[model samples]
Every structure is written in C-alpha cells, then in structure tokens.
Target: MDEAALREMLDAVRSGAMTSDDAVAVLRRLPFADLGFARVDHHRALRLGMAETVYAPGKTPEQCAAIVAELLAQPGSSPVILSRADDEQAAAALAANPGGARTRATVVWRPAAERAERVVVVTAGTADQPVADECACTLAAHGFRPVRISDVGVAGLHRILDAVEELATADAVVVVAGMEGALASVVGGLTAAPVVAVPTSVGYGASLAGVTALLSMLASCASGITVVGIDNGFGAACAVVRLLPSAVTTRV
Candidate 1:
C-alpha cells in the first residue's frame, strides 16, 4: 500500500472508524501478491520510491495480462509499466485494461497524479527511436514528463548542439544510441543534469550487437555518465528517476 492509504488506515483506527482487526484484513495481502506465475510486489513504491514494472519479453500475452490485472486490483498500487512489449502483447494488455497507453515497444498505466519534474530523452539516430520511445514511455509511467530529442547523433553534431539549451533544463537526461555511443558523452558535456546512457543494438557487424557501443559508453571521457545494458531503455529511465532530487517525495 502507498503512504496515503497507510495513513488513512491508521487514522481510521485512531478515530474509532475502523477496528484493528478490520485494518489487518485490509493489509493482509500487502507487501506482495502471488499470482502463480509471478509474485507482484505491492509495496515497492513504499520501499524503493518507485513501483514494480513488468518486463514483457519472454512472457506470453496472457501471462502479461494476468500480472497487470493483479497489480491493478491492489488498493494503492502505482502505475504499472510493461517494457519491451511486442504489438500482440501491447494489444493484449490494452484489451485487458483499456486505461493503459502504448508506444512502439512500451505500454504505460499512468495514474492521474502528475509529476512536476521533466526529463529529456535524446536519441542518436532514427533507428534508435524505438529504444528512445521506450525510455520516454517508462519515464511517463513513473510520473516524469519526458521531452524527446530525436536524430541527434554525433554524425550530425549540430543537431544535438541545438538541443543543448533544452536538455540543460531537464531534471535528468537519457541518451540512447548505438555505434560507439558517443552521443551520451556529448550530451553529458552539454548538460549539467545526470546522464543515463542506453546502448541499443542498432548498428552493423562491427558494433557486435551493441557491445562496442556499450564499451564506449562504459569508457566515456564525460565526467558523470552512467551506462545500462544494451537496449535497456526501461533501466535507463529508472536510473534517471532515481537521480532526481524530488524522487523521494514523488514516489511512483
């Protein structure tokens, strides 16, 4: 349960509106819920300042739908994010719960409450848009406003240069790229905000399925750049949220 729900429960008990036994019944399934195939963490928002997310790569559409349904049934569950979801999986999830919104490879169930902070998502090229969109969708699910900057790879240095002012205003930045991953370093140099780099598998043979880009990001000369695994847009978004100053107060 979220802090608001917990406080309401306690207040009800204190004011004689609810019995201690009644409160216990309400909190019986808290902390987590087991759904046969998956154990959904119901208290992640309380513990980590963010809710649990569903990664939909290996699971079938039915499995993903079942997990999302369980999460939605909780009393104070935060918005659920389904990352790396294919078209069929997205369709299934949306069919199960019409409240969710879908991008290319990500689905988000954002709550009505909105976050004040904004994050900038910069992609190296058009090919990186999928990963960048995933990062943006994930950030939105976590309550951050994501501003997308597309096709700003190092090859076209002027493109990112033009976005420097805009990027600097964000609470954090997520740079998505492949092929050497120099965009992260460039973005790092331009913005004072924390940079979370995501290397995608968007390059040719020498890229080694983004290993080259991953290594380049890892060895970045930029002062304060961090890197996630290849095509891990969700993880990069989470890192950006963690880096925000108000994340503790804006618990997802």
Candidate 2:
C-alpha cells in the first residue's frame, strides 16, 4: 500500500467505517501474497517508490498472468510492468486484465500519471531499435515520456549533432548501441544530462556478442557515462528513473 492508501485505511478505522479487526486483516496482506508459484511483493512501492516489475523470459504465460492479476488486485498498487514479454505472454497479461498496453517487448497496466520530466532514448542504428524500444517503453511505464532519437550513431556524427538541442532538455539520456558503443561517449560529451548506456548484441563476430561494446562503454572517455549489460534495455530505463528528482519519482 502507498502512503495515501495507508492513511485512508487509518481514517476509515477512526471514523468507525472499518472495524479494527478488518483493518488488521488488510494490513496482514500488505507485506506479500502467496500464489503457490510466486510470492508477490505487495509492499514494494511503499519501500522503493515504484512497484515491482515482472521479467517474463522463463515464465509461462499463465504464470505471468497470475502474477500480474495479483498485483493489480492489491489496493493502491502502482502500474504493473512486464519486460521481455513475448507475444503470447503479452496476450495473456492483457487477457488477465484488459486495461493494459504493449510495445515490442514490454507490457504495462495502469501506468502512473505522467511526470513533467523527460528522458531521451538514443539509438545507434536501426538494429538497436529493439533494445531502444524496450528502454522507451519502460520509461513510459514509469511515468516519463521518452523522446526517441533514432539512427544517430557516431558513424554519422551530424545525426547526433542535429539532436543536441533535443538531448539537452532531457532529465536523463539513454544511449543504446552495439559495435564498440562509441555513441554513448559522443552523446555524453554533447549533453550534460546523465547518460545510461546500453550495449546490444548487434554487431559482427569480433564484437563478441556485445562484449566489445560493453567494454567500450565501461571505458568511455566521456565522464558520467554509466553502462548496463548487453541488450538490457529494461535495466537502462530503471537507471534513468533513479536519476530523476525525488519529487517526480516519489509520487509512484
């Protein structure tokens, strides 16, 4: 339960609308809910300022639906986000609660009210769109509108140069690239915004399945560049969310 929900429950007890015993029952379930296959953390938002998200790689569609349904049932729970969800998993989640939206590899339900702060998601090339899309969707799920800057890798310096004004306005910047990951350094050097770099597995064999890019990002000449694992768009987005001010993040 969030602060608002906790206060409302206390008020109900004070006004005699809810018995003390009834309030205790609700509080008992606030910590977690056991679903046999999963123990859903209902108190996550209260502790972390954001709800727990589901990672759908190894889970069955039914399991995903069950977890999502339980989360939605909690009183005052924030939006539920599912990352790396395949088409089947996405369909099952939406079927469990028809009030949800999906992007390429992400699904969200009851997204929190959008915040005024913005995040910019920049992709190195077309091959990076999949990872970039996941980053954008995750940011949206967390209540931030992400401005997408596509195909702006260092190969065409002018492309990224053209986006300097747009990038400057973001609260944070997420740079997604493969193949040496030089884009992160370039974007980092150009904008004062905090940079969260994502290295994708989108290059030749010498790229070592994104290892080269990951290493390059780690050794970036540009200051203030943080790197996530290969193809980990979701992680990149969470990093950006943490960079936002408490006023924008604390609400959800």
Best by lDDT: 2
RMSD of 1: 2.3
What candidate 1 gets wrong by more than 4 Å, as runs, is 245-252
lDDT score for residue 112 of model 1: 29
lDDT of 1 by residue, 115-136 (tens): 7877889899999988888788
Evaluated against the true structure, the overall lDDT of model 2 is 0.88
lDDT of 2 by residue, 1-252 (tens): 665567788999999999999999988887889888889998887777777898899999999999988888877747789888999999998898788899987999888778888789999999999999998988888788889999988888999999999988888999999998999999999888899999999999999999999999999999879999999999998888777834623654
- Indicate the worst ten consecutive residues by lDDT in candidate 2: 243-252
Tell me each candidate's RMSD, in Å, in order.
2.3, 2.0
Estimated TM-score per prediction?
0.92, 0.94
